[model samples]
Target chain A: MENKRNSQTIAEYIKNWSRKHSLFIMAYGTGCGAIEIPATLTSRYDAERLGIRGAATPRQADVLLITGYLATKTLKRVIRVYEQMQDPKYVIAFGSCTINGGMYYDSYNTINVLEKYIPVDVYINGCMPRPEAVIAGFQQLQDKIARGEADNGTRYKENLEWYRANQHRVIKNWRMPDYNW
Target chain B: MAREKETTLYIGPQHPGITGNMMVKVKVQGDTITNASVHVGYLHRAFEKLIERRNWLQSFTILCRFCVPEPDPMELTYARAVEEIEGREVPERAKYIRTMVMEMARLQSFMLWYGGQSGSSGLYTLGQWSVGDRNYLLDLFEDLTGGRIYHMYIWPGGVRRDLPKGFKDKALKTMDYIEKRLDEYDKLLFDNVIFQKRAQGVGIIPSDKAIEWGVVGAPLRGCGIKADVRIDEPYEAYDKADFIVPTFEGGDIWARAQVRRIEARQSISIIRQMLDKMPEGEVYNKVPNPMKWKIPAGEAWAKTESVRGEVGFYVVSDGSEYPRRVHVKGAAYTNGVTVTEKILVGQNIADVSFILNSMGVCPPEIER
Candidate 1:
């Protein structure tokens, strides 16, 4: 029993270490904050050196970067994408708007608090955070993943009922297939 | 010939090839598209409604969000509309600065468009190179406005600040670098036979319907209209400088690409002229505090020649802190939806993104 427990610990450490090094981001630049993402991913800042690259599909992505405000319409897609990603995924909410709706706070269509419906592992603050700040935020997520402390995906699974209740409350006309994992 | 059954293909809201968060539903018979429809609203944050809730100055922050790649024109148009309604006089220096900023925006936007256009055709090398080369322009914007993507530099009364020291020298140097780089891009993209074959006759925007469908910018210019808001309706210091509205006769993807190619050259020359002939004076005229400021009740319409086309704003003021109604007419509204749908039909599925990029549609502007 003791030998088996030790082997499991070693396996978990290797998994976390591998996960921290390679992050494929599905950057849904849904708002103004998305403008700077290309700047970060492209030659100038080059997030590729840090093992961060863009994934064409949600299933292949490990990190979901929601850049800027999420309208109710986009929120539906965001939830679907977050669910599609594999386990041990991380979410980075870019810009102040994601935290509390920065400029569009008073706007009727925007979703003020993203954390209410989706699990966010890191939040970058700025009206539209610069590439440097975006890189810093990615670094923070990497640190959390390496420490085995980024468990929002696990939390989301344990509280699926509560997350679903919150998600369904705001997203009217929800017609997504049941994602039985 | 046997009758062929049609199948539907949805190409984005998340596809890497499409410009932004918008989908194109195309009905195809084998490789040829029979019917195409645009489904946009993926990126909609309802800017028109949100602008009504905020005061005049507050609206500036959100205005740039309408068109991400070229935001300065939105800021310039909104500011000009408010200024026109109030009948305020802008400083001589501010007009030149506005022109300079607009040209810089045009230059960078073209760089971004180059990345998108070439990348759509599987020329990822040029996309990477141009996008990285574009960092030079962004660095200049950072020096001038203290922000990279959304400058919020061009506002009512005048600019937020004056040109920082040695800005002209840096801008001129960058322009020279870009001028040389354009030749390299020509050899790689324009002069290549593969790109020529892909873009030459694909996505033809018929000249007669071009005006009726409300197509503007390079697409219109590509059809041989030679119409430019900068020349036709001279705003700011555009009249102060001399520049040509380049036109090509084809109206196909190649023609439109040529127009943009020439315009990129024109932007470089215009910036050099503006810098040399720029008058030194106060950069801004003070407006009352945005928190308590109210303008006389009136309505005004203002337009500017953006990289994509004519971007206009119609502001109605009911003598209140918040605008009564702020309606944005982005260049992408017609191009991304109507024009794109029309041109996309009967083309190969492979050319969908290529033709769309040729039109220079910014998706956020369409839904916003």
Candidate 2:
């Protein structure tokens, strides 16, 4: 029994280590912050060197990097995308707009707080954070994944009702699929 | 002949190949698009309504957000409109600085276009190279103004500050490096067989229907028309600079690409002349306290030739610190919506994004 438990702990450690290295980011450029993302992913910043590459679809992506502000209409799509991703997923919200609405605080269509609607593992603060800051935010997430502290995906699944309430308040017409995950 | 069944396909609001957060709903029959329609407003922050509440000075901050890739033209147009309404004079040196800044913006915006156009067509190498090289221009912008993406330097009456120490030499050096790299890009991208094959006869905008559809900028020039706001109605220091407005016969993606290629060189030449001819003087003619500033009840329209096309600001003042109404006429408003929807019909579904990028469809500009 003791030997079996030891092998299971080793398997868990290996899983966490591999997950920390490879992050397929679904970069949803929701606002002005989207412009900075190309710089981060391209040759100058070379985010791929750190194993952070862009995924074309939500099912394949390990990380959802929300570039900036989300309008009510976009928020509905974002929630759908987030739910479509598989287990052990993470989210990195870029720009101050995602934190507290930034300059678009008073805009009627945009939401002030993003965390209330979706679980975020890291938040990079700026009007639009520079490429270096974006890389740093990814590194922070990498650290969290390695230490097994990043479990927002599970938290989201557990508190689906509360998130659905916040999402429904902003989105007037809710035609989303039921959250089975 | 038997007909294939029709099917509906939605491209974006999240697709990787799309220029920004906008959607294209296309009806296809056996891989050929029969009809297409553009759906925008994903990136809209309601900038026009937000501008209504801010004071005159505060409005400049949000103007840059109207079009993310090219923001300088928005600032220039708004400043020019306000200056015209107040009948304020911009110093000679300030004029030169503003002209130089706008040209730099045009160059950087073209770099982004090179990336987007090629990337959507499956040439990822060009996107990587051009976008990486674009950082040098961003570095120059960071030095002159405190910001990279949104400069907000151009203000009513004049610019916010003078050239930083040794800025001219730095800018000239960067321009030289970019010019040298343009040749390498020509070999890698413009001369490649696949790119030519994909771009040559696709997404054709017939010359006869170009103006009728409200096309402007490189896409219009690509239709063999010589319509440029700089030449027809010279603003700022453009009257002093000499440059050619390049035009091409074919209205396909290749023609637009050629128009932008030659135009980028002309921009470098114009920037060189503006730097050489720049005079020494105060950069700004200070206005009254910004919070309490007011102009006579009047309206003015000012336009600038941005990389995408003509970006105009129509400002109406109520003789108060706030503007009564501000309407923006962005090139994408016409080209991205009506022009794109009309052109995409009958084209292959594979070329949807390729055609969209060539027209310079910026979504924020469309929705804002």
Candidate 3:
């Protein structure tokens, strides 16, 4: 009887939460892993089941999923896009690419690690993990959401050590990116 | 037009005109580009680093993400690189199969390019017909490789499976369908005078500049510089297959489009030849289990004539279960950003997308 009552209250809590927040995803699929994001979010995967849809712009996104690696050429844009996302945004690093430079680790123009640059809440492993795995990641994010764990505001604003270490391998002569702006 | 004394316009990373995850910061005076810096990494997966961490076979699946448009070239290059290290000889039949698959991939990619190249100039029909027509090829890919987009079928020793029963016949029929559709494309795209006017004199890359710019594939060939991996260094069954490296001297978007059109024809011819001359033998030579496959320590550079220019995989192995280094040279670095910026300097804003489309700059290649 208590179990039923608890479940009903939890359902009510979820309903209130859904009405208050519409999850916006930065459906950023960087590599072959990206091909599956569309499949999962469309009718097949129905990311809408969790009230998530791909946002047209980063500023509108509630979550930024780094689906693949962070290369030098793409890093600037990644940073820019991450910045454009609203304050309460959560970053989901979708594949091995986002965790560590999965490949292209030694290229002169590429960055080997992603975690150093962005604060990732979820790391889904797979060179290009399957759509099923992607759905699982989404479910996990939803669980985090159910707990009402909103953005910390401190994590990204204050974190620079990880980003600096990952970029140390690149950035010849250790010239820091202009941060005064 | 020179309004702002010093202005910076960020062109991508979130721009609709550019495909995939990439950004080009272009400083323009009025409409003409003054200075440009190509920024990449939005899609960089540190592929070389990742491949080093994974076993040889696992890397195969990872390789496809390098060039989304023509991923097979990367897969083929990685497999051949491993073969070079292990000294594994692919069966003659497997070679023929590889040749067949490569040409088909080339055809589909070319078709997609044709649409993009034309669609940029407001010719939407070409994009519609070709992209939809491409579904036929994707269907075949799905049936044989189990994945429509990334078919991790080609491996070190050989392909994953022999052509499925009736797969060859179906492929031939698809070829026929594509051939029939090409005329419609020709009429709607290349044969149209507006296309000629819009593409002919735009984005000229002279033969002298071609080599200096490090251009490859169709764009370089379009300038009359004869450089094709298939001719310069034949891999798989390219040596046995009879086809010409199509070239044009126009040195503009028209030339690039023309070279691709002619090359598509060459790809079709090669596909027919491979099917006709396909030898009877096992498609796959058994290799160590993927879970335990360890490559001997060595470094080698493998290049393939992808739909894009010279796609290379420079791999280093340290006699371990995984590669020590695997750096993929996606054509985007040179063709996608560097060259596009150089040529886009004097071009109008309207022609930017058109010229980029003609260059076939798949963004993931740049991002990777």
Ranking of all candidate structures by their TM-score, best first = 2, 1, 3
True-structure RMSD for candidate 2? 3.1
The ten-residue window of minimal lDDT in model 3 chain A covers: A172-181
What is residue B29's positional error in candidate 1, in angstroms?
A: 2.3
Q: What is model 1's DockQ versus the real complex? A: 0.58
Instruction: Give the runs in model 2 whose Cα sits over 4 Å from its true position.
Output: A1-8, B1-4
TM-score of candidate 1 restricted to chain B?
A: 0.98
TM per candidate:
0.95, 0.97, 0.74
List candidate 3 stretches off by more than 4 Å. A1-181, B1-6
What are the candidates' individual DockQ scores? 0.58, 0.70, 0.20
Q: Write the per-residue lDDT of candidate 1 for residues A47-115, one digit (tens) a residue.
A: 999999999888899998888888888888888888988877899998898998888787777889998
The prediction achieving the highest DockQ against the true structure is 2
- On the 0 to 100 scale, the lDDT of residue B73 in model 1 is 96
Per model, how much of the real contact set is kept?
0.56, 0.63, 0.31
Worst 10 residues of 2 chain B by lDDT: B1-10
lDDT of 1 by residue, B1-368 (tens): 97547898878766777787788999998999999999987777878998998899989888988888888999999999999998878999999999999999999999998889876999988887788889999999999999888899987999989999999999999999999998899889999999999999889988999999999999999999988999999999999988888999889999999999988999999999999999989889989887998999999999999988998999999999999999988898898899999889889999999988999989888888
Top candidate on TM-score is: 2
lDDT of 2 by residue, B210-230 (tens): 999999999999999999999
Query: lDDT by residue for model 3 over B1-368, one digit each (tens)?
Result: 76677467776666545555666677777887777777765665555666666788878766886787677988999889888988888999999999888988899888778756654677756765777677677778877888766888898899999888888798888888988888789888888988888888999887888898899888999999889999899999999999999888978999998999888888878888898899998989888777987777898889998988888888888888888888778776788878888988877776777878888888877765
